[model samples]
Structure formats: C-alpha cells, structure tokens
Target: MEWKPLPVGIDDFEKIVTGDYFYVDKTLFIKELLDMKGEVNLFTRPRRFGKTLNMSMLRYFFEENPENVSRIFQGLNIMDAGEKYLDHMGKYPVIMISLKSMKQPSYELAFEMLKKALKGEFQRHWQLVSDSGRLTDADQKRYLRLRDLEGTEADYADALKFLSECLCRCTGRKTVILIDEYDVPLENAYFSGFYDRMTDTIRSLFESALKTNESLEFAVVTGCLRISRESIFTGLNNLKIMSVTSQACGEYFGFTPEEVRRMLDFYGLTEDYETVRQWYEGYQFGNAEVYNPWSVINYVDSCRLNKNSLPKPYWSNASSNNIVRTLVEKADFSVKQEIEDLIEGKTIIKPIHEDITHEDMDSTQDNLWNFLFFTGYLKKIQEHQEEETIYMEMAIPNREVRYIYKNTVLRWFEKKVEQKELSPLYESILCGDTEKMGKILSENLMETISFYDYQESYYRGFLAGMLKNIGNYIVLSNRESGNGRPDILLKYPSVRGKAVILEIKVSKTYQGLEAKCQEALRQIEEQKYEEALRQEGYSQILKYGVAFYRKECMVKK
Candidate 1:
C-alpha cells in the first residue's frame, strides 16, 4: 500500500503544511471567498469542523507573512490560484486573535485572555516596525508619534487602526483582521451568568475596532453559534454571513463523501468504506453529502497504525451537551415518542430547520425537532416538495456520538424516575413473579413510560425500553408478527437460559380481557414462539400475556 499521511487531531495550517501532514485541498475555499468580495465574513459551524485551521490557512495565504507563506502553503491547491495574492499576503499588519482560550471560570481570567491577545497583536506590529530598519519620512513621523497612543478603552481600536495604517504606510497594503471563536466569551458567559456584561464588553470592543476602521481591508469571524450581528457588529450594514447553510462556501468546512472515498482509496482502506460511512457520513449541506473531517482523519490514523481496520466515532468528542439539554427540556409528547422511535431504529416524520446556526432550541416541542435537525442530530430521510414538508429521521452515526446521546438520554430518564417508586415493578419483573409484576405494571410502569394513544408501536416500545432499564436481560420487542404484525419478545440471556415472551392485547371491557389474553396466547402459539426459542438454543420458554386498558395494564402468566 502506498504511504498515506493522516493529519489526526491536527488543525494548525502551518504544522499541516510544513510537517508533511496529509492535506485536504480546502484551498478552493480561498478562491470562493475572494469571489464573494465580502469585506466581513462570518461562518458558524459546530465546534471542531476545521474552522480554526481554515482561518489559519487563510491567514497564511493573505496575511503577508512572506517567510511563513512560502513554507506553509507549498504544494497546496492555493498555489494553483496564482501567486498574485501571495505577493500581497503577509504584507499587511494582520491582527489574528482566538478567544477560545478565554473559557475561564471567572470573567477576570477572560479579561486576561483578551488583554493577552491584544498584546500579541501589538507585539506583531512592533516586530514589523523593528525589522524595517530605514523607515520612510511618513513612517518615521508616525513611528515616533505613535508612542503617545497609550492603552485605554478609547485607544484600543485606534491603536490597532494606527498600526494597520503604519503597515500600509510601510508595506503599502491594508491589514486583514481575523477573529476566531469570537463567541467564546458570550458562550462562557451564557453558562456562567455573565452574558450581559461579556456581551457589553465584546460589543464595545468589536464595534469600535471592526465597525469603522479604514485600515482594515477585510475581516473574518468564526464561531460555533451565531451571535446576533446586531448585538456585536452594530455597524453600518456591510456584514456578510457565510454560515454552514449558506451556499457561498459550505463545501470548504466539512469533508464531502467524494473526498472521503478518494482519501480512503488513496490509503487502501476502501474495503472499510461502508463502515466509515455508517459512522461519519450523514452530514448533508444542501446537495453535498459530507462527513465530519475530524472523525475521518482520526479513523484513518487509527486504521493506518493497526494495519487498516475502520475505527469508531472520531467526531463525537467535540459535541457539547448544552444544546442537547435544551432539546430534551423542550421536548413535547410527540418529541418523546419520536425520540424513542429513533433510538429503536424507526423513522419519524417532521419538519426540520434548514438553517440552524443558533445554539438553543425553541421552547416548543415541534421546534425541538427542528433544533435536532439543524445541529446534525437528526437528518431528513425523505422530502415532500409538493407539501413543503420534510420527513425527518435520526440515527447515531458513530459510536462516540451514540454513547454521548445514550448517556444523556439515560441520565434524563433516570433523573425523571429517580424519586418515583420504581423498585416494586423493577423487582417484580426481575424476579419473574407474574402476580407482583402484574400489580406493579398496573400500578406504575403503565402510567410512567411514555405512550401515544394512536401509536401502539410506541406503547410496545416503551415496554421494551422499560424492560432493558430494569436489569441485564436480553429484552427484545416487536420481533415477528407473522401476518406483517409486531410482536413483543424478551430474552433473558443473562438469566442462564431464562427467556420470556410477552404478547399484549388492548381491551375496552373486563369480559374481553380473557378473550384478548387468549388471542395473545393463541398468536404466540400460532407464530411458533417455542420453535423460535428452540432455534435460539433455548429449550424452555416462559410466556406471559399483558392486557392494557387505556394507561392501565395487567399481566397474566
């Protein structure tokens, strides 16, 4: 197999280029971006989709860092776009700052990070000044007079403007401004109760610096969530948002399936392509089918080291629970039923938000589905263009994300049932004591588990989910209903060949209970439940019939 470079867990452009790292040619984005001619571009992607690295690549290509540009973008696709831009690159006094490091517990630490980034910007400008030994008369005048621009709230923007002007004076080009994770402070503040203050501080600083600066040629801002432009860039309306849903540059952020397959072929891991797709290939932006790049690269690295076996869930690590919490809390009766269906590998119908650049879900149940879709948790299975409706569905693409969502859902369900009396029913079912199980079932389990009146499948599903929650039993539901029907079956594999089959029937009258129970038993017998158990290598089987009256349930053995 030919050698393949896996840039696993690497997002720095300089290291990726100079260290002989595997590079994906997202440099096509530079051409696309330059085509837009937007002075202010804002991109919102979920965390860790190579936003930082893309910005770094842009900085390397356009920031006028003459020495670094030559080394950083060598053998890259941007080179094909022509070197005219490279001559202007790094010629300006670029101010690149990342607010990601400001995830401090306190606002003071965040302020410190802000100050540190500003200082770095200042030092970069000073370094350029020191390198230009013989300054022009205009440069000399600005240089000597610039000492009076001391640090203050009013001076910060002017100071950077002055430096960019100085660079244009000396290098003859306007400076490019790059701000990464610009929403970090607000995100941190949202969780920490400092949202208003942080918003105020950042707004003041950003509005001053980015709003009316003549020395700035263009500015780019990247963040996970979309903070309102009105809140931060309360400027004179020159802003252009290039969020993931935007057609202008969506292809550059995530790895399209074609790219993943091509890279797989390059590494001779094409045999594991389906497995890779199962884990990371559900993300779609318009017509583009993309995979999470971080997951793909990490999987490739693991596969390479292990001599080519596909890896599990490389992108789930970066997901945040804040949004999931919002989704769960805002879920309605329909949402709960839909979620259970999704967990059980069934599809549900709903509308999804095409543009989900925001972090939180709307407080409505229907909106939760839209939120899930936008954040990439749920995806569209089919579209009904005639009706203007999308048939939304969901699955755990990778094990990592599966684990996270499972744990989160488990925790949520656990918390809900924590103070409720679950011991009686749980113990009754575990002990295989039918009478007590029936009493507990009638008393509690039937009422507690979520169910839909119209969706009998969901009621059966709730029973299954409940059985699994009870103990280490191989609980299987909706197995084989001969005439295209659904049967609820449970196999207690951990109980040393102890297996149980439950058949449920709903009745409106007490007299009909016995008849429904008899029908359930007859169906089990007709469907050859015993034969299925024998085929499973279990000779003996315990059978039970559960009858339901509205929310009330009864079990008989």
Candidate 2:
C-alpha cells in the first residue's frame, strides 16, 4: 500500500493543500454547517477532535482571498460539489483566529495570547490590502493605520471589529469569522481561578463582533467545553450550539465506524480489527458510532512502518490530563469506585449530558468524569434504556495519554504529600523500629494500594504509588532474568543513610503473611536480589517483603 503524508501536526489549510499530505475530505460537513444558516454557531468537542483542521478547511472554503485556498481544495471532495461551490470557495472575507494559544495560568498570559492571535489575523487581512479592489482610499488609509499600529497591548475586540468592517467595505462581502478553541481561555480561567477576569475579557470581545456587528456574515466557534449561554452568549439570541451530545454534527466531528473500517481496509490492517476497536472505537455520537480520528490516523501511521507493532496510543499525545488529574484529586467515594471499574474495563452506570446539571459537581470530580466520558475519554460500555442510564468504561485512549494522566496525578499527589509532614514515617522506617514501621505501613500503605482479581501489573503499580509516598525512591517492576524476575524491587535513597530494598509478592492463597514473606525472601535470594543491590555500591541492603489482601496491604519480615 502506498503511504500518504499523514497531516500529523499540520493544521494550516495552505500548508496541507500546497504541500503533499493525505486529506480526509470533510467538506460535506461544511455544506451542513452552511445549511444551518445560523449567523453564529458554537461547536463543543473534546480535545484533538479535529476542530483546528475543520476551521482551517472552513477558511479554505470561504475566505475571499485566502493565500492558496483554491489550490488546497483543488482535488478534494469539494470538487464533487461542482463549480458553483468551487466558485464561491475563495470569495468571502474570513477572519480566522484560534484561542487555543490563550491557555495560561494567568490572566496576563491569556491576554497576551489573545493579542497575538488578533495580530496574526490582522496581518493576514492587511496583506490583502493591495488586492482589495473594492476599498475606497479613505478605507484603505484606515486599514493602513490599523496595520501600522505597534503596541499589542491595546484592546483587541475593537481592533478586530474595525478590521471586520474594513474587510466588509474592501471586499463588498460580510466577513466569515472562525474562532477555534473559543473556550480555551475560559476553561483555563475556570480551572485556575481567573474565571471572572477571562469571562469579562472574552465575553466582551465575542459580544462586540460576534453578537452586534452587522459586517459579519457568519461565525463558527469550536471549543472543548461549552461556556453557558448566560455567560458567553448573553442575549445573543442568534447563537446555536452544536455539541458532541447533539444529534446533528456529531458524525462530522469524529470518524464514523464505517469510515474506520474503510480506512483499515485501505491500510490492510483489517486483521487487527477487534484489538483496534477495543481501544479507539468506543466513542458514540448519537446513532453513529465513531472512533477517535487522532488515534486511528496515528495507528495507521504506525502500521505503515511496522506490520506487527500494533497501534499504540495517539489521542493522549495531543491532550493535557490537567482536567482529569484535577478531577481525580477531588474524587469522592462514588467517583473513585467508578474510576476503579473503568480501569478494569468494566461498565459504570451514569447519565450522559452535553452539560452536566449538578452545580456542586459541575467542575468537580464527578462531573469532570462525566465531561471526560461525553468528550471521549471514556466510552459507554453498555446502556440500559429502561432505566435511562448508561454503563461507561474508561481507558487511557492512547499510549501518550496513559502515561501523561498517570504521571500528572502522580506528581500532583507527590507534591501534596511532601507539603505535609512525612518525616515521622520516614524516620520510623530508617530507625528500624519494626513495630512502628508495621503500624505505619498497615495504616498508610493498606488503603493506598488496591488489588484487582488477576491484575499483577496493577498490583505492582499500586504498590509503587504507595511506596512513593515514603520519599524519593525508584521502584522497578518485572525486570528480565534468566529464570524468573522478582515481582517488584523498591529502592529508597537518602543522604548520609543506608538505603532499603523491598521485594513485593502477591498472595494467591489465604496462607498467613509470615509464610508468604518467608517464600518471598527465598525467591529474592534465588533471584539474586542481593547481587543486584550490591552492584549499586550498597554494602548492606535491608530487605523487607510485602503482600497484599485486596485493598489492604501488609508488610512482613
């Protein structure tokens, strides 16, 4: 099979079009977007749901003097729309801006991003000034003045509206505005506690042009979360929201099941069908079943190189787990249980919503999980229509996301533990107070580590997290050996101190932990655990063995 240039990280229309790249024609959705005829439309989709590329496509199809829109869509599916569509393709004024860059922990940084985006759009329009045949001398002079302005610290909305009016006068056409990731700044603000300021900045900016301006032809806004109507839209009655939960435009955002099957067929990886489906094919959009395009494309790219490597995680690469990590940090009992079920790939019962209604939980742990589910982090495993509830299962969608979310949460909780007084536990262990160590281990480690029925790796990971709370340490699992490797080897390093080594084991039988610990010690000797530690320059290694009983873990000598 011939390998096509996967758009990979390219979201620019001119770059994708003028350069050689594989294009998935979604111009059909462009027709549908236009069919709605709403002056202002908001589309809320999860991260890496192709919002940026779709906006770029919109710019190619509508921008009057786009640098190279015609060439980009030359051989695309839009050609099937005939010359009528092709003639109108590059014939409208377009103000394409993205708020994705506006993501920051501070209001000042967000404002800087906003300024940069506006400046970029202004420069694009300014370049078209010479070709703007319809602009009067006075209008041209005003455009020149706006372009010549230096300080980026000025109000962006007024400048953007002035540019829109200038474009309308210059092109004799209303400007089509594409605002990608419109909620990024607001989402950041909400997450980081600058909510009011971001809301005020963006709400004013959007209202000025998106709501009141007559020079605007139509606008499309894409974001992960939907800012409430009362906050962003305000009295803008013309606004229409096309959310992931919407029946229409759902299939347009992500690749449908049929599309996935056909693409798999095209790539000749149909043999790995079930495995691929299990990982990336759980997302459902109303009646149409979809797979994450980000993951699918990445899987295809992987298969192109190695015939048997299998598709790894892709969606996780483009997303930040801050939202999920924040959710996990604040998770309640019910949410923790649900998360446990998800990690086990078991279905969890819940309601799916475009916007969750619970105020206390809206931005909290419970609703964040719901947000992740609806947005595609977790997929509905089973549905009970009679009860009006859905059973959802969660998985790290891609390899990148798996490590990211776990590592993010790991670091977060690690910082929390360090902030508190952890010296008592460390001191107790260092002093070799077996009694005190036993009590602390029983209390602290037991509840912290959870065991699954047949998940040896999970048990190891759980133990690792539990031990990490002790102090700076390295826990290695499942290392290679000639005969067999130890289950886990934990190393605790401290300045001016002797280090400790822990060998972990799982108790399959209901035998007492003392017997288990004795067997574990025997295995450690057989596995040459002492040699492994001595090679690291430790003259003496204090060995401790541990065993688990469901959620309760015990340390044995």
Candidate 3:
C-alpha cells in the first residue's frame, strides 16, 4: 500500500489538504483561538515547529473565501468542536502576511521587501476591496496605491490597518490578521545593524494594525522569540502571548508523544520509534513532552525512500543555528565550564527570561541561555518560580540538537586553533622540543570541549587542525605508511627536508596517559611507520606519540 506524501516544505493549508499530503491534525488550534478571543495573540515557538503551517491553517479556517465551498476543513477535529466555533469560520476577512521573508541586509531593503509582500496581500484582496460600494473614492485610490507598490514608507506603515478597515466596510465584519514569523525582520535587523530603524517601523505597523485598530476582530502573530513589550509590542495591552513555556497551547505547535507514535505507526515506522524518540524527543513545550515535528516528518519520509537511513539533524538546517555559536564564542571561563558540562550530558540551571527581545540577545550569558531555551536548542526539564524570577533547568533536547551544539563547538574550536600562533607548535615539532610541544598540546587540548567521548579520533582531529596551518610542512591524516596508516604525518617538500609522524591514543585515566604514549611510540616503531618517508629519501625524520586522558595529554618523542 502506498502512503500519503509527507508535506516536506509545504505549509499551505489548502495545498496540504487538497493535495492529500500526510498532515498531523493540528486543526484543533482553530477552536482554541476562537475561544480565547484576544484582540491580538502572539505565539512563540521555534523555527520549524509548525508555526507557519498553523498560521496558514488559521488563515484558511477564518478567512472569507466564498469560492472554496467543498468544506476544506471537513472531517478535521475543528469541525466536531461544536458549531459555536465553526460559526466564526468563513465570517472574517483575513489579512495574512509572513514577515519571515523580510530577512534583509539593510533597513531600506527589508522595508522594500516587506512593502512588496504587502502588495501581494493587497492583490489577493484587491477584488474584494475594489467592489466595496461603502469604500469612498479616497480609500479606493489609497488601496490602489498600496496594491501597485506606489505608496511612500509612511503610507505603508498604516497600510495594514487601512486595508483591514476597507475590508470591514466591504463585508460588515472585522478582519482577522495572521502574521507569520513577525519577528524575522527584528531578528535580521538585530544582526544586520539596523535594529532600531526596523524596530521603529515594525512598532508603527503593529501600533496601527493591532494596538488601536477597531477593524480587527482578532489577530494571531507567530514568531520564534517574544520580543519584549518595550521593544516592539509596546502598550498592546490586549496581546495574549502563548509562548513555548505557556501551558495553554503547547500541544498545538509540536507533536505530542501519542501523535508521533501514531504517525510512525501509519508509515510502518513503529519499530524505529525508540530511535526516533531518542533523536527528536525531549522538547518540553509547557508541560507537554513533544518531538520536533519537522525532523519527524523528514525522518519518516527518508525511511520511506531508504529503509535503513538513520535520523540526523533536520531542524538545524531550517534556521541559521548561530545562536549557540555566539554563546560558545563569547563564553567566559565559568560559562565555558558550564558548556563543557552541558556537552557531557549534564543539565544547567538558568534564570528564564521569557520576555526577551533581539536587542538584548547574547548580550549576557543569562540572556544567551534564554535565547537557546526558546529557540529549541535546549529543553526545559525542570522549572520553579522564586519570588518574581523563574529559574529553569535545561539540557540538550536530544541527539539531533546535541549534534548541532557539538558541531558548533567543534567549528569554534577549529577556528580558535586556526587563530593560534602556530610558530611555537611548528618550531617545537621541528627542533625536537617535546616539552614545549607537550605543553602546547595540553593547552590546546584543555581548550577544546569534546563531545566524541574523548576518543582517539577526536584528539587526532585536534592535532590535525592545529598542524594544518604549519607554514611549510604539509599535514596528512591517516595516510598509509610502510606497514600501517599513521595517525598524522607532516612532510617537508624537499627530499632532504624534515618529516614528522604522530601516533595518537586515548588513556583510561590520567596516570595511564604516559603508558599510552609509550604504547603509541612502540606501535610507530614496530609497524615501520617511518619506512615510507625513508623510501621517499627524507634524511631526517622525527616521531612522536600523543595520548589524551580527558583534558590532560602526554607527548613522547
């Protein structure tokens, strides 16, 4: 039997339903929204946790689309949620827009892109607004100006509110606004050096459209971070925020355990449930234990294509994932120790500042932890409220997120190694200064946070990264020698030039490092590791054995 195609990158509600793709039933999110009835609702979830699809679902359910009369929401949970909830369906005009595409390099460009996006939305509703006899000549011309992208920056700021009013006049019903990834511009601007300008522009847009607009029946805004009230949603007293930590709508964003199991069972992937849970489970949104929906879908799809494929980091590619990099790069001594502990599968406690804006992101270690917590890199295992501040115990969510962190830390370590003054390490290896070489090796070893369980391969890679920048000698890893592959080999260009061989080992304990180094040296000699270099006519050859026990190292020449 063939299975329904998984919606890999498709977020459109109509497309997913009409095209018969496999969709996790999140339609109940509509019932919850209508019941809450906030003037504005902001949902804070991670990047690929179905925020856009949920918003798209909302647009289809609430928007006034008379042409779609085949019951697009037929047989969903929302349909059985009682007629009171369904009564609001197809009753309001929707001003749907996604700010996610506004990730631009400059404020001018971001503003232009946003304006063009609004122009498309205007075109979507152009016929409705143009046919409204209640709309005056001035409003019609203004709508045309916005639809053609002929409006100035100031005119565009109030365009959303103005369009909502025009639609209200057309249908005698208020408009429901759905904005996806509303914080994208702010996030992009924060990193793009235009935060203040973008903030002001967004502030005006939200102020006119959400804060004081009478034409709005309700609005739902989805984004990753909940920008502080002072930063963007200033004075919007009616804005109800359901963040990842909020217990109200947690199950609607990511997949619950039962939902995931059923999805796995549907695709005959039930046997791989444990592996899937290990890699994708552990995220705690509210009190609901959930799996990364994006990763689960992609993994199930991969299993369909190739039954033996293993799960990898799927959500990491959906976003930049540089938050952890900034956290690791700017970590202080204590923070560095905490990070090392985290890499060792330990939990760290941090003050949970849920109300954070992009401006203060990564400014301090505490803020960085909050950013990581909300951005899905870390999972909230435990939490408590003390006085007024909330403290959370967070750990790496799963292997997939751990893979991201380890990769980031490895890259950061590699960059630090590249930035090191290799003249000393190079000189030590050349002049046979094993003392300086061991010291430098130990120092560099101590600086790296290993997630590979401190295996011999990790140390080998570390040594290779350090030696890769040697001025003249070329470094080769695991290259075939006379009788065996050397852990590392660095050769000078000329036949008369010097050569060096490095053999690496991992010790069980600190005291065993010296013995392991000796064993490595014995392997180098007994295996005739230097015979190939001698065959190449290198007159001088130096050999060293390197061993590591956790952060300590031993070098023997």
Candidate 4:
C-alpha cells in the first residue's frame, strides 16, 4: 500500500490537505484558542517548530473562505468536537501577513518588502472595498491606494487594523488577524542598525491592529523570539503569551511521542522510532516532551527514498543557528565553563527571561542565555524560583542540537584562530622558542571552550588550524610520515625552505604536562616522523612536542 507523502517543507494548510500529504492533526489548537478568547495572543517558538504551518492552519480554519475552508479541515479532530467549534469555521474576514520576507539589509528595503507583502494581503480582500455597500468613498480610496501599491510607508504602517475595519464594515463581522514571524523585522533591524525606525513602524502596526482596534475580534502572532513589551510592544497590556514555557499549547506545535510512533507506523518503519527520538525528541515544551516536527518529517521522508539514510541535524540546518555561534563567541570564562558543561551532557542553572529584545541581546550574559533558551538552542529541564527570579536548569535539547553546539564551537574556534596574527607563533616555532610557544598555546587554549572533552585529536586539529595560514607553509594533520602518522606537520609547499613537526599529547593533570611532553617527543623520534620532511630536501627542520591539560600547555623542543 502506498502511504501519503510526508509534507516536507510545505507549510500551507490547503496545499498539504489537497495534495494528500500526511498532516499531523493540530486543528484542536483552534478549539483551545477560541475557548480562551484572548484579545491578542502571541506564541513564541523556535524556528521550524511548526509555527508557520500552524499559523497557516489557523488562517485557513478561521478565514471567511466560502469555497473550501471547511473542506480541508473535514474529518480532523476539530470537526469531531461539534457545533460550538465548527461555528467558527470561516467566520471572520482574516488578514494574514508574514514578516519573514522583511529581513532586508536596510530599513528602506525592509519597509518596501513589508509594503509589497501588505499590498498582496490588501489585494486578497479587495472585495471588502468593492462589494462592501457600507464602505464610504474615502475608505475605497484608501483601500485602492494600498491595493494599487501607491501608498506611502506611513500609510501602510497601520494597514492591518485599517483593513480589518473596512473588512468588518463590509461583512458586518469582526476580523481575525494572523501575523507570522512577527519579529522578523525587529530581528533584522537590530542586526542591521535600523532598529528604532523598524520598531516604531511595527509598534504602530501592532498597536493599531491589536491594542486599540475595536474592529478586531482577535489576533494571533508567532515568532522565534519574544520582544519585550518595553520595546516593540510598549503599553500593550491585553496580550496573552503562549511560549514553550506555557503548558497550554504544548502539544500543538510539535509531534508528541504518540504522534511520532503513529507517524512511523504509518510508513511501516516503526523500527526507526528509537533513532528518531534520539535525534529529535528531547525538547521539553511546558510539561510535554515533543519531537521537532520539521526534522522528523524530513527524516522519515529520507527513509522512504533510501532505507539506510542516517539521521542528520535537520532542524539546525533549516534556519540560522547563529545564536549558538554568538553564545560560543561571547562567552567569558564562566560562560565558557557553562557551555562546556552543557555540551558534555550536563546542565547549568540560569535565570530564565522569556521576553528579550534583539537590540540588547548581548548586553549581559544572562540576556544571551535567555536568548538561547527561548530560541531553542537550550531546553529548560528544571525550574525553581528564588525571591522574584525564576531560574531554570538548561541543557542542550538533544543530539541534533548538541551537534549544532559542537559544530558551532569548532567553527568559531577555527575562525578565531584564523583572525589572530599567526606570524609571531610561526617565528617562535622557527626559532625553537619553546617558552613563547608554550605561552601562546596555553593562552589560546584558555580563551576557547572545549566540548571535545580535551581530546588529543582536538588539540591536534586546533594546532593544525592555527598553522593553516603560516606564510608559505602548508599544514597537514595525521598524515603518513616516515614510519608512522604524525599529528601535525608544517612544511613549505615547495619543500626547500623549512619544516616543522608537532606531536600532541593530552595530560591527565597539570603536573603530568612535562612528562607527557617528553613522552610525545620520544615517540616522535622513535616513529621517525621527520623522515618524510628530510627526504623532500629540506636542510633545516624544527620539531616540538606539545602536551595539554585543560587550558594549560607545555611545549618541548
């Protein structure tokens, strides 16, 4: 029997339904949301945790679509709940906007993208102005300017609430507003140096539509990070925030354990469930444990095409995991220790703040931690309160996220090494200045956070990367030499200039560093590691043995 194709990368509700894709039922999100009856609701989730698709599903379920709105939601769980919920099916004139495309390099380009996207939304509901016998000539002209893309940026600022009013007047019903990735503009602006202007623009849009608009029945917004009310949401007090810290909508955004099992069973691949759980299922949202729905679906699709495909870090690769790198780079000594602890399958305690603005993200270490926790790099495993502060025990969410941390740490370390002046170290090594070499190596080690558990191979790679751009020298790692493999070899590409050999050893303790360095040097000589360099006609040679213990290193020549 053929299975329904998994909806990989398709977030449109109608497309998934009509295309016969296998969709995880989350329509009950509608029932729960309506029951709560929030004036304005905001959901903060990590990227690709089904926020866009859920927003799409919500938009389709509530919009005033006459043709096929109810048809797509048919036979789902929401339909079985009876008439009270079904009465809301296509009840309002819905306005949907995605700020994702507003991520531009400058405020001008970003606002243009916003205007273009808003123009499309206006065009979607042009019938409100054309068919609304209640619309005045002024309203029609206003709508026409937006529809025709002739409005100034200020005119488009409060477009949603304005559109909602016209929609209500035309249909004699209030409008339900849906905004997807609402923080995209804010995030972009903060990084692009135009944050205040973008903030005022979005603040106007949101306050008009959400805080002050009487025509709005309700609004739902989704984003990865929650900008504080003090920033973009200033003076908004009627908002209901449902984040990963909330138990209300925990199971809606991601596939639960039961859902994952059923999805695997549907594809006749239940045997892969354990592997799937290990890679994607450790995320804790509220009180429920759920898998990353995006990665799980993509992984199962891979298994369908090939039975032996290995699980990759699908979710991390989907969006920018730049937060991980930022955290790694900005970490001080204590912060570095915390990162090392988290990467080693351990946990660290930090006060959790859900609402963090992008502009002040790195102002304090705690703010950065809060950013990582909310953005899905770290998961809150335990929570406790102390005198007006809430602290959480956080860890890397799962192997996939851990893989992201490890990979980000390695890349940041490499880039850090590449940017520093390596000429001094090159000269020190050439002059057999073991004192300067040891000091430089140890200082560099003290600056980086190691997640490889201080492995010798890590140090070897670290040294190799540091030597990668030495003037006229080519760096090789673990390559076959005279009688055995050498850990690192720095040689002139043309072989007539000079060469250096390094053998790395990891000491069990600081006291053993000298002994380990001697052992490494003995092995280098015994293994004839310099024969390959000498055979290439280099008369001058430099050899050193390096031993590392945590952040301290000893170099012997």
Model 3, range 41-87, lDDT digits (tens) per residue?
Answer: 99999988999899888888887877753388888888889979888
Superposed model 1: Cα runs more than 4 Å off: 66-68, 83-87, 130-172, 307-310, 341-362, 365-371, 380-404, 423-553
RMSD of each: 7.4, 4.7, 2.1, 2.1
The TM-score of predicted model 2 comes to 0.81
Candidate 4, residue 429: the lDDT equals 91
Q: lDDT for model 4, on a 0 to 1 scale? A: 0.87
Residue-level lDDT of model 2, residues 1-557, one tens digit each, is 56767777778867876776766667777777867888999887778878899998898788765276666677677678766556667778889888888888799888877877777877777756567677778666665555555443434546667778878887788898888988778777777778877887787778888878989999998887766667767788888987755677778777887777777777787887777786677666556677777877887777777979666667666776666676666665576566555554455555554544223245545467676765556655545444655444445443344444455545655565556565676676556555565565556433331324434555566545545666566656664323465665556574334556556666666456556667667777777767866777666466666665455455655
Score residue 372 of candidate 1 by CA lDDT. Answer: 56
Please provide TM-scores, in order, for all candidate models, with all chains considered together. Answer: 0.73, 0.81, 0.95, 0.95
Pick out the ten consecutive residues of candidate 2 with the lowest summed lDDT.
445-454
- After aligning candidate 3 to the native by TM-score, how far in Å is the CA of 465 from where it should be? 0.8
List the global CA lDDT of all models. Answer: 0.67, 0.68, 0.87, 0.87
Counted clashes in each candidate structure: 5, 3, 0, 0
What order do candidates take by TM-score, descending? 3, 4, 2, 1
Q: Candidate 1 clashing pairs?
A: 63-90, 64-89, 64-90, 64-91, 65-90
Error of 2 at 75 (Å): 4.5
RMSD of 4: 2.1
